[model samples]
Target: MSSSGTGGSDYDVVISGASLAGSAAAILLARQGARVALLERRSDPEAYKVLCTHSLTACASPVLAELGLIPALEKAGAVRNEGRWYTRWGWIEPWAGPAGAELPYGYNIRRSTLDPLIRARAAQTPGVDLLLGHRVTGLVREAGRAHGVRAQTAEGEREIRARLVVGADGKDSEVAKLAALPVRRHDNGRFGYLAHFRNLPLRDGISHAWFLEPDMAYAFPNDDGVTVVAVLPDKKRLPAFKEDLEGSFSAFLRALPEAPDIDSAERITKITGTVDYPLLSRKPTAPGLALIGDAALTADPLWGVGCGWALQSASWLARAVGPAATGQGDLDASLTAYARTHRRRLRGHQYLAVDYAASRPFNPVERLVFSAAARDASVARHMHLFASRLIGPSRFLSPAALAKAAVVNLKHRRAAAR
Candidate 1:
């Protein structure tokens, strides 16, 4: 809570906003023997953003496994999920085709439960100095290089110096703000309202996503006897939703034919809503500062990929830049490497999420696939795996598979036309 001088605290890395991404980075950097100063604005360690749908796709499992957080996640009572999607045409079964691997998939770990767990683990790690309640108000730039950050504490303002500054401060990142990173924003013309419930007819350990034409809904079974449901609809509908939160939410749930009937289901938490704002990859790194998680890029949450991507990207940033910050490589090269890797790994997925967020009722390719799935069970299974992020998009849309889907769809169309 005190500032000694212009330069201080011989830390290797200073991480702003100690949420999931920041905490994960701190843990990994500390594990690599780098002293990390984690500065969080909130005094309360339990304080966290609650508007998220709280679902982690299987794509992030490998990263979690590598970080040794998988065991901790399981111990914290994460629920395993492998479920079917109810589309307008029919039920799309889980992918078990020749193209997709058969594996038990995914989890619905609530951030309220998972965030504190990861943060606590990060605090216990050897090289991390967790500085709670200190708000990073400015960046310290000397010779056009970020040496550290200036944070306002309870007593006064203090300058914390480090070799590198990592911004895991989420979508509206302050570090990114100070660095003047370029950002491209996309308005998806929709908003989301999410909350938890009890006594909903949720399949045990399985999550369900309903892909309605213009609107969407999802239910994730999580720890503490709670399940999360989010309603994503066009922004024009917000007024009605805002007028009566509970009634609008119930109506939205009932409108989704694929969703389970939750009209009479008891609410576990207050309904939360967020205006639709989709963010793509911004300038992730510059000199000695780098952005991780939503601060770097944020896709549509209809796919439930945000949390997984955050943890995964944080791990990637740590691995890519920690060594350089500790003098293992050129700091610029390390930051560039992290930026490149994050973009390469996530670009395709983000593009796909954006395409889906447009609210167009099934493009031609999707029509063929869904039509095929309605007629052929095998096709539905593959569609299921693809949606779950279990397989790459290329594999899901392979020429051979597309041809098979076309054949099946043609036959169904003829049958219906007759």
Candidate 2:
């Protein structure tokens, strides 16, 4: 690793932001013997991102295992959420275990616990230089290609140069701003609020979500017997929530049919919320720069895909750029591969998530699928696979699955008529 000195071109990659994506990227690159500088604004390793629903879907299991995080997470009491139940048409429970016997279960743990774990692990990696309390001030560009960053640390200003600069900084990324990357944003019409509760009367191993038409609520059983309960209501309902945040929050949860007995649970944290969560998508790469995680794409948080995608995108970026970062391939081609891979894997998912962020009621196709899942065990399993993100949207909406969903719904309708 290169020393943080003036105009020092030290590392192979300078990754901004030491959150999930940044830290994960650092670890992966370092493991491949690429020198990495992982920078974070926060000095404390234990400090974590507070305003997030820190749920990781089954899709991230492999990445977590690769990073060697599962054992530590389990040791810290993180709950293994075997499956999710949706209250769309009715209580739609998928298969009772993991996505498959081979797949590891999804997990729910507070970011307070998760972020620090990832950061610490990354810091321990051999070729990684973890720079805490380093705030990026500007991009160091040469001939229109990003090569490094200008950052302000406690000692003084320093310039760290690299073959590649990764903007894992986040949605409001300084690198993205400096690079002037084209961004496409989608407006979100719903406001989200959540808090942690102790001893919530929910099933121990299952995460539950209620799709109450234009509104949504969830209760995820997490580490230490704490459940994270969140509600996303259309902006039109903001007045009621603002009038009485706790009362309204409780009322909303109680209003969900067959909801958990949240009112009976002990509230452990203050209610926190955000009204502006616009979905953001950006071009993932440029000549010498790449964006990963939320810097590349941010969708509605209601789906709890943020944490999972953060780790997944970092893994994708690492795999795509491994050869180049380790000095065996064309850097530009590797970045282009990463960009294409990012879009191919996440674009469709983001589109659907952003569309739902509009806070509109479910359309005909959603109704058909949800109704079928609620009625048929086989359909429920398929829906679970999609919801868990073990399969892509294309696979979930395949001809065979669609036909089965239609048949399941048709049979239910005919049986009801009788």
Candidate 3:
């Protein structure tokens, strides 16, 4: 979009970080007539985040649809992941629902493709000015309220003013840091390892998750016949992976039930991920500032919620602040609404994810429901709603859901005795 109406470098919204959340916030805000300045540290337009879960969940499907990415994703051969879960009890595979009903399928495309595509969309948007290689150096604030940012650019440093400033800069957020936003950090007790495979077929483009108590493994289909295999074993199992990452990773996958033939598949990407990815959270908003994506809430990768949360949170921020951003409403009230929405939808999910990140085994309730889900279709479906982040713990533990699990377990016991 031309800068005719949008005040040159200044805008209604100045969003730091140009990854998933930043690009999404820029796009959504711009769509609502809010002028946006999307700043990125990297000059190369194609730069993408290297370490990522790369699996968007059903919770993000609506936001993706709103972003008009479904068509582009499909055209890029993004895999529609509708999959099964594995527990010690057995597999929890939910049955397909009514014909023609909208399926809760999530995309599993690599960041290499998804990142640039979305960033380009943001750049081409009507009111967003995406600044490449603009490293945010500081926040312009008065009396504890953010107003704009000073950024280091190619020619020199520049100050970009805005009504709303967003920190979407991932786990290590410079905007949050410059603002001195206190973060609540939790220790994640396991290391994550992920790599992509070429020519590895995942039938029906279905993803697979094995919840092996404290350890986890996944084989998720991505675009172009590529499958991403990941393992998040307890730190106790680190020595083996450290010594031989490929061997250890492959051995773990090969041992799974109905395991993929990674032996025959060509390894495309190097095995990479972080061992020190601690869970992080902060107040998502202040006077004129807001944090989106990992900057707002960094959860354990074991849950595969990163991509979905990034997309969903960006949508939330945009909706919460769009009107105010364009001077039609109050900005602080918008921030408060976004904060409430963030806490309501994600607090419970993050609590569970961070708790599990400590390398703990399943509690009694988890074990009971997982075993029942393995045996009963209805139980499995209920579990899927929870595991996929489609429903929170409260709904997952509702009397109706627990009744199904209880009944399934009782029947299984009787059948075993017989």
Show model 3 residue runs off by greater than 4 Å. 1-9, 96-103, 203-205
- Kindly give the number of clashing pairs for every candidate: 0, 0, 0
Candidate 2 structure quality by residue, lDDT tens digits, 96-174 = 4355544346789998889888999999999999999999999888778877899999999999988889999888988
Q: What is the C-alpha local distance difference test score of each model? A: 0.80, 0.85, 0.86
**Any runs in candidate 1 off by more than 4 Å, and if so which?**
1-9, 95-101, 203-205, 373-381, 390-392, 411-418
Per-candidate Cα RMSD to the true structure, in Å, reads 3.9, 3.0, 3.1
Measure candidate 2: CA RMSD.
Answer: 3.0
Give the per-residue lDDT of model 3 (tens digit) for 75-150.
Answer: 9989877788888887788654445544456888889999999999999999999899999998887667787999
TM-score of each: 0.91, 0.95, 0.95
- Candidate 1 lDDT, 303-407, residue by residue in tens: 777887888888888888776767666778788889898878777777777787777678888878876876786787777666666676788889988999999
List the candidate numbers ranked by lDDT, top first: 3, 2, 1
lDDT of 1: 0.80
Backbone steric clashes in candidate 3, count: 0
